[model samples]
Target: MLQAGMHAFILALGLILPLGVQNLFVFNQGAAQHRFRQALPAVITASICDTILIGLAVLGVSVFLLKIVWIKTIFLLAGVCFLLYMGYVMWKSKPAVSEDEERIFSPKKQIVFAMSVSLLNPHAIMDTVGVIGTSSMLYSDMEKYVFTAVCMVVSWIWFTALAIIGKITGMADKSGRLLGMLNKLSAFVMWGMAILMLLSLR
Candidate 1:
């Protein structure tokens, strides 16, 4: 159980360390919101979505989904379009002078976007299905439970930490220049990821 837990933790940490769309969205919300509490909805929504994906992957549902080529293709195309749209929106966004001026997404909006980024993003789905799901094949029964639990825990902790980091940075940047720069970088990163996804589709 210990070994399985450790393996799950390490694997999840490695997979999540990348600056992906979901992480970027969470970080951006943390930085844009007036208070850390205001970003909780996004943080919680993203973590829950990941938990669901991880659970589905461990159960082999993702594997079945992958067996259908058209489903994968459709998901990939949708993910690319969503990423490109998000990038364009981020690129055009203006820096807010203060928290009050920042465009805060309602809880429903945050949930929708978070769900889309987690469930609709083909890369995220593949990572869960391919990496976490594959790794779970090495464990069984209680060990498998431990592995899944550890992975889910790691995800929750990592996202919380990410939001905290963003909040701290937001607090420090009174002039919002840093936030503006981050938004631009996020836009480029999203576009780059979309392009990579497109290339993979070819």
Candidate 2:
């Protein structure tokens, strides 16, 4: 159970750290408003997908994923690099004080964009489905449920806070300093996570 929990947490961190890079950039570009508004539908969709993958893991899908050694390694490495690059982007990014706010705030576009980003992203699939689901298989059904519940709660808290903050603070205007800091912090987190994952691979 302890091992399963650790695996789930690590996998979640691995997946989320990279995803955060892309999201934060969009956030800095003032797309956060769009993202926040569309977050509800996007998050809901992601949750359902994650739940299904986790269920499959409980049914022994993880073993299949684990066997694809090269694929897992490739994804793991790619996820790490993507995060580091995103961090770099954030570090160099300035706040979006654009004059075209009205043009970019379409609800349907936002929701569709959110869905596409979260759903089609290979890194996300690997983390939630391959890593977390695979790890969850180490434990019994009860423990797997507990682990999944914890991970979902984590996802909910993160996305909710991000959307709310983006809406309230207006990432376009007053979030430059805050966004800069977040980018740096996210970069460090990603670098650390990547290193840890590499170590585990060896």
lDDT of 2: 0.55
Against the correct fold, how does model 1 do in TM-score?
0.94
Q: Compose the digit string of candidate 1's lDDT tens values, residues 1-202.
A: 9999999999999999988888988998887787888788889999999999999999999889877989888888998888898888778775555655546766787787777778777777888999999999999999999999999999999888998998888888888899889889988988988898899888
Flag regions of model 2 displaced more than 4 Å.
1-11, 19-22, 25-39, 42-102, 168-202
Residue lDDT tens for model 2, 1-202: 6765666666665566554533543343333344465445544544455555555555666557656989778766765665555445445544444554553434564454444444333445555666676666666776777777666665555555555665556644464566556556656655655566567578
TM-scores for all candidates: the values are: 0.94, 0.52
Best by TM-score: 1
Give the Cα error of residue 90 in candidate 1, in Å. Answer: 1.3
